[model samples]
Each structure stands twice: as structure tokens, then as C-alpha cells.
Target: MGKGHTSANGGSRTEGYQYDINEKSILGDEWCSMYSTTAPIKFEKSHFETAMMHLIREPNINSTAILRADILREAVFEIEPNGKPKVKEEKTQDLEVTDPEAKKIGIDDLDVRVAPTNPLLNLHVVIQIVRRIIPRNLYKDAIMNQTCLIMNSSSSKPSTSLVVYTPHIKAEDECPFYIPHVKAVGILFHNNVLSVHYIPFDNVELLRDESQRAVRTAWRLLQTAYKHSMGIMEGYEKRVNHDQVVDKVDFQDCYIAFKKRYSKFLVDNWAESTDPKKHVFEDIAIAAFLFELWKKIYGKDFKEKIQFKDLGCGNGALCYILISEGIRGKGIDARRRKSWSIYPPDVQAALKEQVIVPSLLLRPHPEVRKRIPHLEHNGGLFPVKVAHELIAPATIVYSSEDLLQSPQVNVTEFSPDTFIIGNHSDELTCWIPLLGYPFIVIPCCSHNFSGERVRFNVRKSTLQSSSKSLGNSTYAGLVDHVEYIANRVGWKVEKEMLRIPSTRNAAIIGYENPFLDQFPTQEVYDVIIEDGGPDNWIQNTMALMKRNPRSH
Candidate 1:
């Protein structure tokens, strides 16, 4: 929506029509001015039609933070036998376009086929209007309702297409470089060319200077949408479907309230080496997600239904936030972090130090723990036996003592009600889904089944699903790899692309469906064992259990 107007001098030539669009007479210059731009490239008629529809239905595609759009009414006009045009089908409801007192200034005349009261009445024209609602970014209390009108021409000869503008322009309505600013901005596809016409009240400068350039850029994008055979909101519907996997409204409300209470305090006194803003907001967002998820799963009384175990929880911020909100949970990591002391006593108590040796890994590996070889009471350990040559090498063999005495949680022993949170849990990320407990794992830097940092290669079949270009090195690939593993097991998985400050925001959730009897089955353990036996990992994990002098 440009501020200033160009002098209406040259009439535009309609592609197949014999007559030229007389600029001076078509748009009367009594109380306002106009600015127009034209391009010679031609576009498919459908391209023009689809773009117009997107401009109405999903205006947020071209702008930022626009809340919603609703079509108020649609009026289709047909040329009468006597050359005049009358409405054929219309749903005026409360918004009658023909109201004389409304002062809705629009196209004054059509120098081509329309000869009646106005060009909007041209034969086969559909006058569609939408009420766009946008909330102010910094000032949420303020909102604006701007009505956009789109008139598309008949599919027959002349080939002149849609024209976009506001229903009215008031001099006193001061606004930012927002679309249809103050007055009306028109985007027209006519005569195989693209054009932009801005109308401003004669007394007001409207959105000038910076707004001038912004409006030009806005129209240019509209032109780009037309030039290519795509809608500006091409995948808008698809995106909404993908994004709504979680309850967005509830998540947003929870996240904002949590951030307001905790962000400033944490950022001011962060004790970690990572960026405070990144870590703090991420934890806040994850905590918010969990709160909403727990509510849906266990109802409002979710606090008593289950407790969470966060394996490899970094910084313990997420545990702190959840515990502060009255949810009982614990954060376990390989080494204690300095940030633990910054939290209150409960969060401090919840943060425990130890490496996670999944109970599954400790099952078959007797060699993993030789029961303190130097201890006098301990009998000489016998040589391990092999069940089947293939299964023996792949699986771990450990006695009941290893399960009881070792400083690691046994996955099989956890109560069925435990909910696991794997916030960048590294080596444990893949194991969370397999642990048979309902869990959420957010993948960060690439890591294999072992904590040895190695990028997971995306499978060929998965790569071609939606993102054919998904490379092995990308975070998307890593997230997809986790999803693949979850699907390989029998657990029904739900994924949500979280709204956090960092790029590591994909949350993969696995659970047993309550309505349907669907729980995870370990049908894919052969391939899992082939990846790497637990011997190397067991030694590496045990090394971390040695205490580091606590950092102040």
C-alpha cells in the first residue's frame, strides 16, 4: 500500500479487448490520487484467480502476525438483457455493499464492457470481501479490522482479471505500513501485465516515506505470486494441518505465562556456558509443552497421575520450571551442572548426577560389571556363555546384582505411569521411545545410539516423503531419523514442531493409545543390536559416574 500517488495519464491496454482503459475517466480524481505500475509478462488466468483467493483467505502469507481472516459476503453480478448489470447471487447478510450511506468509494467506471452504475457490476464478476483481523505486536490490547475487497472479471474475452482494494478510506485513520494503510491499495492483473494503484485521501499524507517503500515491496511479492504458477499461500492449508498436531492455543498461553515469570530472573543469573536466552526460552517452551500434554493425557489432575524422569536433562531448567508449577519430576544427567545451585531447594534436590545405563542394556552383559574384582567376598567371575552366536554378541549379560546395585534406573522396573522427558538426552534419545514409557524426545546435535557424536543418515524412502532435499547433515534429517526409529518400534508416535528460540525444536512423542490398544513392541531389536553392542557404551557411561568436584 503506497502512500503517494502517480498522475493518472496513460490508459492501459487490455490484452484481447479493442478498447484502452481510460485512466482519467475510469477512476475519477475528484477527492483522491492513484499510483500504478505495469509489467508485460503474461500469467495463466488461474494463477490470477488463485492469488486473489489466497490474498483473502490467508493474508498472513504476505504479512506477519495477522491473526485471522473471514469472508463476510460474496456478490456475483450478471449483465441484464438491456446491457445493465444486476446482482444474481448474493449473501449480503449484515454487510450490504449497496448501502448508499456507507460511502464505500471504489472503481468509478469501466471503460470496457461494464456500462452500468459501476465497473464492479461487470458481467460474471464476483465481488468477494474479507474482514482481516490483526493484533498489534507490542500492544496486544489494540486490534484493527481492515476489509479487503477483490473483484474478479469474467473468464471470457478481454482477459482483464482481479482488482484488490479496501472498501473505504478515511483521512483520520492513521496507521503503520500495514496492508491497505489508512486508505486503499489496489493490485490488478490486466492486459497481460501487473499493476499497483494506491489511493490516499487528498488531505492526508497517509503512510509516507518508509511506508512508501514497504508498500511497493508488498505489491512486488503479489506480482511474484502471479508470475510463478503458485499461490502466495500455496501450502498454507498443508502447513496448518501439520502445525495443528498439538493444541497450539493452549501451548501458547502456557508458554507466555511461564516465560513472563521466569525469563528475566534466569537470564540475569544464568550459570551455564550456553547462551542464556537460548537455553532459558527453550526450557520454558518445552516445559509449557509438557504442561499442556500432561493435561490432555491425565486430565487436570495430571500432577498426581504420573511423575517424569528426565534422562540427560541439561541445566535442569525444565525440571525446575515444572516442579515450580507443582509437577513432581526429576532431572538426571552424566555430570552435575553449575546452574543446579541457582534453583531453589526442590529443583536442587530433583537434579541428580549419574549416567543412564538403560535397564535393557544391562540385561545380558555380565562382562559389563565383574563385581569388584579385588573384593574378597566376590567369587571368581565365570566365563560368559553364548545362547546363540548372533544373539550372544549383540546382547548384554548381567546378574540381578547389577540391576540392584548399579547406579542406573532399570527401564522395565519403572512404574507403568512414568512419563519420560528426553531434552537433548544425547545417547538416551533413541532409547527413550524403546523404554516402553510414554515420552517426549527433542533432538539437538547429532548423536548415535552411543554418545559418540555421529550424524544419522536419513533413509532413502523417508527422504522422498516431503523433503526430497533433506541431507544427512541437517537437523531435519536427525529428527526424521528419530521418527523412523519410533515407527520401527510399535509405538504410535505424535510429533510437534515446537516454537522455541533454537533450531532444535522438533519434539517426538510416543505413547500407548488409550482409546485403541496400541503400545510399543520390540519387534525391531535385531537391527538395534546390530548397530552396536552395549560393551563400549557401558564402559563410557560408567566413567561419568565418578563425581566431579561440584562447581560453585
Candidate 2:
């Protein structure tokens, strides 16, 4: 049972088991149940208590905190002559932060009177069910109603004990009787030992599973909190904290601006099955981060001097946002997304549909070059099964001398300060670093030079050294490999766990190297050529290509 959210059974025991009603009912109206569990044995009392406090303050610790769970608002507790606790008007910050003495309070240990701005708003059950079943319109209406009541609810008259208010289904509400209107969960810390207990009203047979889940979740949260306090939770921390690598550039302002200006349009026009909030939020964050990065590198006058090429830019929303921000950039992908049309004509012009092939591959095929005089500037290896007209319907190969004059062959040539952006660039993830320029690769699908989905064995040094090996998941391994490759190629690499909406958020960054003169283009070329090069890579890319009929 939770305080201000207790079971109907009137359970008020702290140390031993207590059952006020023993009769069992199908809906569980008569049985009273209390559950207790111990905390991790390794954690010292002080450390565990502090961790627990932190968990309450930051329930988003493991993304497990119930979205509606009551945040401690204001409360007062006083023990009456009889054992009942009396509540008085009290105001303060979250108890998790203000009340260190609260650690001594256990289940049914102290009666508290609370004035929460969010009484029912903190109910975990309400949050879970409403999110699943209620329509957005109804949910908004209910929230507005709750907000009005919360604002009007006076703190002048506090309840007796912390177990004051419980959620009961009213005529309009659909709460089950088995569920206690008000319940309280308590944690006790004494002499380096910890105990957790739940006080439910009459323990209904139906609530056994729910009660057990609550206990298990609490136990897990305790362990997580303990691990977080000790700084040993390498895996757990990564998921909770989004911005891992801090740079001089701050993109928060850019993100704020995007949300203020463009969020409604993006949300209304979202076409994918994935959550629109996350997709749009991620792009905004990317734009903000990139803009700041550009500002930091180019000083105040860094507009046209910096140009970007987004390899495998899906949907082209990011490119649109960047271009709209005054940074000149173009996105190239084997296929164009439908969202491309939604953009204005100017932004549409910045997006191109083309497959990228390393220039080195063209140099080796003399037979293909003889037929195409413009081999140096324009040469394409098409999929064996897919017709060229389907993929590159309007693509025209140009001469190397006219490289600067061609749109399709722009990838083959790079001017100084060209920035390669690889957001989920699948096959292009690994190649971005080898392109010998400043680039940011947010790897999604792992691929080798042959353009096949191949997972690289993450280096022991990189994996073991990383504080964020959340798991040996394939995605994490791929991100590690990309970071490792960037470092291996002598590109002063920097890795950041972006504050993006997606779980696959690691960004491998390469900037201008001070040792560029020592490790020039030839050195980069020698390394790749010696490592079997892109000799067979082009053939594989062409073989896998599937022409998009829609492009035609």
C-alpha cells in the first residue's frame, strides 16, 4: 500500500505481518496483506539511503519511474495520542530532497498529511491505463479538470497520517474496489540494514500479482539507485543520460527555436508509423548540434564556407532544417522518401536521389571506362537485377573536368571544409571516416567495404574502456567499431552519445587534424589500399542496389 494511496484493508504495521481481515473474496475485499523485502546487502546504509533519495528526486533514473507517480509536493505529519498520525499545513520542496529524516519512516510507520498539486495525477495505475485506453482529447480534458481541482485544494486542513487520500473508482471513475483508494509504500533504514514494505487495504486475491510486480520493481529500482550512487552502473547510465560527450557548442537554443517555430507543422504532417514527437525532436536536436558545431569551427562568418553532404539522409527532414537554417547542404540517398515532397521547392532542390560509389573503384575498371569517357567524373555500377532507369532514371554521367559542374558527381569531389553528415548512413557508415574529411557518422546498420551488412568485432580496448557498454547489443558493437575505425584512420576522432530521440544515438565525429601534413591524403589512401581497399566494394554495392520505380 502506498501513502495517500493505501489499500482498503486498513493495514498499519511496520515490523511484523498484520492482517485485519482474513476472509477471502473473489474480488479480494476481505484479505489484508503486507509485503516486506530487504535492500542490496552490499550497499552501506548511508549510501543506499542517499541513492534512494536520488531515485525519488529523479525517477527517470532507469526510465522505469511511473509517469504519473506522485512527486512529493508538500506534507505535514504528527502522531496523535492514539497511534493515528495527524497532518498539518506544511510546504517544502520534494521530500526526497528536503527530508533526510524520511528514511526512518517505514510502511505505516508515520501518518502524514500531504497537499500535492498532483493528487491523482501521480497515480501510476491512472497514468498507465489512461495512456493505453483514453483518447488524447479525453485525456486532455481529464488533465485539465484535475489541474483545476489541484489548484483549488486547500492545504489548511491536512489529513491524519500520510495514508490520507487513496484512489477509489467513483460513478464517473472506473476504479476497482480491490484497488485501494490510497496506498503507501515505506522504506526503513536502520543500523546499515534496509527493509521495504507495502500496506494495502484488505488484501484481495486478485491483487497478488500486481503487489508482487510493485515489490519486484521497487527491488530493481533500489539496486539501480545503489549502482548509480557508486558509479558502477555503466550499462544503466547510458540509457538515462542522453548527452554524454560535451563540446563547446550548445544546441539547446536551436532545439528550442525549432520546437517553437516548426513543431506543430512537423507533428501534423508526420507520415511514419514511428512516434512523430521523437522523430521531429531528434532532427531538431541534430540541427541545433550541427549549427553550433559549425559556429564553433568557422567563427562568426561560417555560413557558405561550410557545406555538408548527408549520405543516406532518409526523409530529408534534417537536410531541409539545416538548409533552412542558412547552411548550404544536400542530401543524397539511393531512394527518396515521400516526405521530400512536403518541403518547399527550395528545400526539395537540396535533396538528390543517387547511389554513392567511391571514386577509387572507377579507376580500376578500364573496360567500363572505355565506353564512358566521363569515367573520371561519372561512372555507376548498377544492381545486376535492377535496371539503371529505375534507380538513376535521370542521372547523367559527366567528365572529370566538369566535376564542379555536375550535381550527381559532387560526392566524388570534395572542396576544403566539406563536412560529411552520415545520419543512420547504413552502408556509408564506415566509409564516411575514410573519405578523408571532417564528418559526423551516426551509424545505424553496420556494413563493410563490400556494402554487405557485416558486424565488426569490437576492439577490446574500445569496448572495455568505454563507460557505456550498456550491453553487447549489435548496435552498441557497431557504434564502437565506427569510433575505433575513425581513430585508426588518424582522424582526430570524438564520439558523442547524442541527445536524440532514438536509442541508436552515438555520433562518431572527425574534425580537422593538426597532423594533416604528416598524415596526408596519400597516407589515408595507402592505409585503405593496403587493407584490401574498395576493389570489390563497388561490385557488391552495385549488385545489392534495387532501383526505385517511383523515382522514374
Q: What is the C-alpha RMSD of each candidate to the true structure, in Å?
A: 10.1, 12.7
**TM-score for each model:** 0.69, 0.58
lDDT of 2: 0.51
lDDT of 1 by residue, 255-351 (tens): 7678877988889989887789888988898899899998987899999999998888778888989999999878888788888999999899988
Error of 2 at 186 (Å): 11
lDDT against true structure, model 1: 0.58
With a 3 Å backbone cut-off (N, CA, C), the pairs that clash in candidate 1 are: 364-396, 364-397, 365-396, 365-397, 366-397
Q: What is the lDDT, from 0 to 100, of the residue 234 in candidate 2?
A: 29
Per-residue lDDT, model 1, residue 392, is: 40
Let me know the TM-score candidate 1 reaches against the reference structure: 0.69
Query: How far does residue 395 in candidate 1 sit from its true spot (Å)?
Result: 23
